[model samples]
Target: MATTTGTEAPELTGLPLLGSLFDLKNDSLGTFLRARRDHGDVVRISAGPPGIRTTVYGVFSAAGAQQVLAGESANFRKDNAFYQEVRESFGNGLLTSQDEDYLRQRRLVQPLFTRRRVDGYAAAVAAETTTLIEEWRDAGAGTVDVLQAMTRLSLRAVARILFGTDVDAAVEIVEDNFPDVGAYVLRRGYSPLNVPRDWPTPGNRRAATVHRALYEVCDRIIAERRSSGGAPGDGQDLLTLLVEAESAEDGSFDATELREQVLVFLLAGHETTATSLGFALHLLALHPEERKRAHEEVDRVLAGRTPGAGDLDALPYVTRVLKEAMRLFPAAPVIGRRAVEATVVGGVAIPAGADVIVAPWVTHRHPDYWEDAERFDPDRFTPEAEAARPRYAWFPFGGGPRACIGQHFSMLESVIALAMILQRHDLEAVDTVVPVAPAITLQAAGPARCRLTPRRP
Candidate 1:
């Protein structure tokens, strides 16, 4: 057994054998919030039964978040079972790669995500948003499921940008299959013991089917692109960039690796932005005053013209609305890692090889840092107020060297889509409360239903 150092975190009391397993699997967001409120910054949580039990250190304070995700990030590696499952399912893409593989991947992928480069995708984002606006308008005054609608819009935008003319080949495969894949990853990832995946269990069989379809479509698309000898149209799509992205020493991605990278982009690029946009729209619908402020900002900045990337800075209030929505419902609510060695976070000792989780959901609402934390207040993100908070106080995108490479892209898509929506329609909350479930991402468990009234005369 490894020797420990410093003060140990308090253990969260749980049911006899299952510990916090059921609570965590069912209501993770609420569980993390209550754990933070009851146990303070660092809490030791055990799940499962007997010999197979797993203990995870929940780091929920802003200071603890900064330390775990940034300050002592090197001491905390992405070697946990959850990451292992994600790596196995998704391949060693940017989200799951570690050490040398991660470094190489980051180096090759970083150039494509620069602000200027991501800004180039804004036109694609706006076009997609316009398509959605037209669809809603055409549907008349009927209520729309915000989550479902945003998910399609975001997936289509990313697929179009990634595949160009090959977009049709990839969209349905990714959009239809990712949910099943995510559910499989979660179930197997959290289980302390699992029957061998080759045994053909019901879950395993379904997962295999979904994985095959997803991989086959991506492989077909890549093959066609390679054989075609040129990219679609002007060759500005992300897939073209990936095909051409090469370093003298590192070289370029092979067909299989290209599929992995594409899978990662589709998963991270669309879903996270969808979660933010859906929640932002829902929050606005519920809060009329804030929605009004957003409307005024969008109307003033856009002036009845389609918004472009250049207008990003011109709509500060709209940006704040998006920021606040992310604060409340971060896409990746709970991030898991393993302590590489014994470490102290927020005065709590973490054992070597301990499973650790930093929850942005709880950290963002820390009573010590946020006033009236549950309130939907976009002003909380103003320059002065943000500067007053801890660095990790609001990390919808994970922090440290592994911080989301798609940060700029997600923001750009979100800002453009959100601003455009507010410009075209006035939203009313048809579903007063949106119940959320924290999975691979924060999911709206119930419909985020809203009634859209066209703003045009």
Candidate 2:
């Protein structure tokens, strides 16, 4: 590997072999902030003691992020270590696959998320949201587990609406273990140790057990649907579409492929939505003025009625609130790409197989790009304001061709979830100031607790 252009990135100094791994593992946001504060935009992450030094680059600048995620996207792929940790459970799902296989998966599954197909699922989303609100009503509103409530609501919605299944044991498995596995995979991303899945470690064993259950559930869904004369291409649910979808050259997804894709969609579809809803509610709880504005907007728009697909665009501030919340604590914090061929990130040479990190967490909060970078301002995402910034500057779902396939679906779902929650209840924070827990997704270190009081009859 030889360097050609641009200044050599300053190597970050830390303990031997472990290098910056410990710091990254413990405080990912803090470590990234300090690196940008101390070092310039492009910083060499680790040069571990002798045998372990890898050419990993932590990219903080928007231009550098663009070079990896969009400009040279073909040169970089998702077959890196962190994705590999995911591959063990997901197999060749869209999130982890590369090249031809990834392209094939994308083509097969994308149609299900198109505006029309997603529109068809709106009824289920609303119904699931209503069901959750009823459950909260029954609980009588004192110090509710906000994340837990959102998680259940989100899983039920994803399960019924997208997968077209009743919220069952399988959804429970996903709710239980997806985060655990996610935390492990992301932990491996920053830590020096690369524990093998076969090692029978507690985390490894737990992930394996959960994955097996999830796969079994996928198979069961497919089998039951088939038995009921609901074959692939039924054009009913996303699961059915994937079961039946194929390309000219690519044949149908195999049993293994179906399981992996279903699991990935289930985790990606609901986890981010739940986390975002939880954070949004928590933020509103902290700021009464914002909460009041949200309530006023909902009253003016829905007028005490339930939100529907027609009201998606009608409630712009709710969407803006979702946008700003995601900007503050993005679901996917650090998006990574490994150079399959030698490429340059902003002219800093990156050899093949080296990791390049592009973080929304860093770029979205850049003082240069964002005014009053730390404040919670939903107005920043108004069509006019959003159009003013660089496209990649505020990517929460991600960017480029390999961005989250369910982005539109996620956005619509977030709006509906938030609108419904606001219409039904006023949430007050039971605990303020939760520590950040970095995982495959970002979350509070503990359950985000809130007291929900019914705002509607």
> Model 2: runs farther than 4 Å from truth?
1-4, 187-196, 199-204, 231-235
lDDT against the true structure, per candidate, is 0.88, 0.78
Please name the candidate that would achieve the greatest TM-score relative to the true structure.
1
Candidate 2: lDDT of 332? 84
| Candidate 2 lDDT tens digits, 190-299 | 55567677998987787678767777777888777656666334448766777678778777888778888877878788888888888888888888888888888988
lDDT of 1 by residue, 1-457 (tens): 3335679799888999889989888887888888888899999998888888999999998878888888888888989888888888899999988888888888888888888898999989998899889888776846899889999999999998898877767887887899999998888888888887788888999999999999999888888778876577898888888888899977888998899999999999899999999999999999999999999888877889999999999999989999999999899999998998898887889988899999988988998889999999999989999999888889999998889999889989999999999988899999988888876888888999998888851
Alpha carbon RMSD to native, model 1: 1.7
